[model samples]
Target: MRADTVEPPARPSAQAPATSVPVPARIAAHGASAADRVAVTGPDTTLTYGELDDRADRLAAALQAAGARPGSCVAVLLPRSARYVLAAAAVMKAGAAYLPLDPATPADRVEYILGDAATAVVLTDHERAGTLPAGPWTVIDLDEPRSLVPAPQTPADPHIGPDSLAYVIYTSGSTGRPKGVEITHANLANLVDWHNAAFEVSSDDRASQVAGLGFDAAVWEIWPPLAAGAALHVADEGTHRSPQLLQDWLVEKQITIGFAPTLLAEQLIAAQWPAHTALRTLLTGAERLNRRPLAGLPFTLVNNYGPTECTVVATSGEVGPEGNHPGPPSIGRPIPGTLALLLDEAQRPVGEGEPGELVLAGPHVGRGYRHDPERTAERFVTVRTGDGETVRAYRTGDRVRRLDDGRLIFLGRLDDQVKVRGYRIEPAEITSWLTQAPGVGAGTVTVLGDESGEGERELVAYVVASGDQPPAAAEVRAFLAAQLPDYMVPAHVVTLDALPMTPNGKLDRAALPRPAVVAEPAASPAGESTDDVKVWLGELIAELLNLGQVGEDDNIFLLGGHSMLAMQVVSRVRQRYGVKMTLRQLFRGPTVSAIAAEVAQQQQEASA
Candidate 1:
């Protein structure tokens, strides 16, 4: 049998377990032995091990008095801070799963999540208490002095077992609403154990917490280090946005370990660093990595791959320095205690090195989506192993191919497949090739209708320039034509200063601007082409802004054009004129006449 084609490992016995210690219990043990050590370092405050334990214990008692139980779900709505970690630990100590809610979440969405989870208690700061929608749950403001009234000095020890619910994280649902995923203590414990052992986390290490409160990466960032008795430094909002600022902060804090989303990590590894630094390991996931770090890097760059359904990570490998390989590094083999299988549509194992759906079975798998039995039944199923043992598994809709050494390379999502002109295309493959083009920093591809609503889809590419001069549309197309089929080349290539991203650091596809209509009436006379372009662009702007008509010299911004709308206008101009138009040009001019003059000049320069 081929090495990569080996059958899945034997199913774990029901009586055996992956981890013997729960997360809360580990934190308590650390508090006893390292009471004076700093547990959390926030922007404005610091908490010692004793203080964190006592405060969380007091909060847990209050929650219990407020009628929280072993199976109840508590809601935590606070910004990233020392209190945020305290609240999560308190909920687990009270024997209730904590549901994270970002304060910035829309009020209606927050209301829906609270109602759906049947949350009985909500933990937040006093300043943000009024922001919450009126709900049936009891609110406890951690900032209020009365809320922490004297309680037992020791930690609260409720009956929290491996089977007890740990946390319920909500993920974006396909139906435009969010679904809560229930993770048990066993699942969380396995992650904590694996993280601590894999990363060599210890009390002397200082880790950074950069993910938001609602993202699943935040859970992974918070618990692993704290449970191991290390100090977790909370990064400010600005540090997370700029790669240079983040690297400076990491150096200033002397952080030994850090985690960033895939996009940010790609930028961070490419940025310059000091000759010697405290950082030893950098972990990144939540998207496919497109580039490898250059040689002579100080730290080990580890690329990880997994869905929220299977804890924070299932496969991980250290990415070596950039090499002559044609593609990015492979997501390493499955972690211990986890079994991964690649199966086709018929549930049969695919041949070696063939792409198939990634199915995971083990203790790391989440219990299932909360209040979504149908979806749970569909995604999480029982599969019989080659040895005839049955194990519950989650069918990750992601496609992957196994390497000879058992490493997996992430293909695009099964649902994200696009069909253009009777040919199936994976946009990720195109994006990867675009990023490899000269003078291109990053890129993404999207599919949109032809604007006639006839259901004809075309691929639109957006790229960021690595230097002052952006790659011309013709040059980019020629480059892609060499690496890809003719049909796979994008119909429109729009260059931008940067790609739009969510607060959690994932690509925001819905936020991508749509390409403009390419069909325009030609000039009536040969000498009137520039005037014709101005008139047509003015009319297009008016139509997009929902105005009856716009004057040639009117400023679009003053006429209610926002950043998103500006991007749309730029996309239209780039496609129509075949020029490398950017948002800066629109912001500088902000009028139809000014943009038309610049466009005409660029066209003249191109001809010259």
Candidate 2:
């Protein structure tokens, strides 16, 4: 870490006033001042500050009685609801860190996290409690009326400290499982304080909680506004997924502050909104943003960047409308109390405007990964700056380039950088340009090995089109070839209506459909029609599934076809013959012959 040459934006500021109040304490203060104000709104519940504070107090007392204390971990396994917010506030009030568990988490993964964190109590609703794996831990159903009782409003805990664990979030690990990241109250307070100030959060503002319950962004979504006496609106499932629905919901609810992941944010910003819409700020993170907002977007579009190890957000900057700026939007400068250093593999600072691994240091840094000292040591290390001072920092595995103005432009993952024919490539760089290509709504590039060549890999591009007609694969390839080097251009392109995303909103690379194979069809047996629709479909199926051959009676799914691949096939058939096909029809008759017959019937009806 070279601090002497580092700019002010990358240096930890000692002059910044500390905003390290425990989150529960801050919320209680807000409750005292704004007791009648709306604090949380959900499908079936609307909580005033007084009611929310009282319920949290009651739950805190129950948790304390159920063996939760300052060092204990309490797991919250509820869906996104007002009760989930109450449970989080209560857990912290009880002087215990809450381990947020997504309701959709696999039972085994839930069991593993519960065991790994040594959770003393589980706070979940009745509907989700039955899904929890049996373990030697207390399970308190939040839906059970008898489980809560009134307690003191302040609900102060002498054991709570700035260094006390606030939350333990589990991020996907490189070892094919999950690892828990331990964040402290100080770390969380820094984020809440920065967010509240940066976004001008106030009691008059209604913030929306749309991120998955277990995502670290949920912490940012919950605490900052609530602490500032703002109302929290829990978006319904449909609103959470559909950008159009979310836009309407935000306008209808008069939500002033909202957050969406990168891809969703791209679509949301491009949409038309009323001139008098109440939304003033739209925040996005959790992935590299590739699109700019449309010219007339009335709100400030802020792009944030951070890892779970650094308490949700490290850098933030407002994104200007398209054409106002060139290239993808920057992640912005480091937030207050945080330091961002761009360092090379040799642990030295990279030259200005050069790419390097972003290493972060300061109060925002978390305690480290839970129960994995070895992995923790590998990622979190003490480094000596040029000033001869040693500081502990978390190494974010992301590759980024710093602009002259000190903002960070995300390049891609350092580990994700692949060498193709001796040339190192950043897929995100290609994607940034790919998304801007004609008729391409969004795209991601990945590397796959050649089927015929040993140890040879080529680029593969998967795109979702902006128009009804997907661009031809050859057209996309040619477009990239014009803008990029020959090696950087993808060898093949696959178009889909939408990209598959994981439950947490990140792109699911593992679920991406493989490129369709090309092969010459074999001759049909004597007397068989060469242009038979069934025979044609069999060939399409074989190529799509990369099968040696597909028989007429063979089921598509049985031959490794999935919903996404089936969608591609259906899209192809519609484009080729203009026949309407639905997923239900595909599932009803999964065999090639059955689908061919359905298509033929549709064609015959059209002709008649």
Q: Of the candidates shown, which would achieve the greatest lDDT relative to the real structure?
A: 2
Residue-wise C-alpha lDDT for candidate 1, range 312-348, written one tens digit per residue:
7888877766653446667777887788888899988
Assess the local accuracy of residue 608 in candidate 1 as a C-alpha lDDT between 0 and 100. 93
lDDT of 2 by residue, 281-326 (tens): 8989988899988888788888889999999988888777777677
Q: State the displacement of the C-alpha of residue 372, model 1, in Å, after optimal TM-score superposition.
A: 2.4
Give all TM-scores, in the order shown: 0.82, 0.83
Evaluate residue 452 in candidate 1 and report its C-alpha lDDT on the 0 to 100 scale. Answer: 45
Off by over 4 Å in 2: 1-17, 149-158, 450-456, 517-608
Q: Judging by TM-score against the true structure, name the best candidate.
A: 2
lDDT of 1 at 67: 67
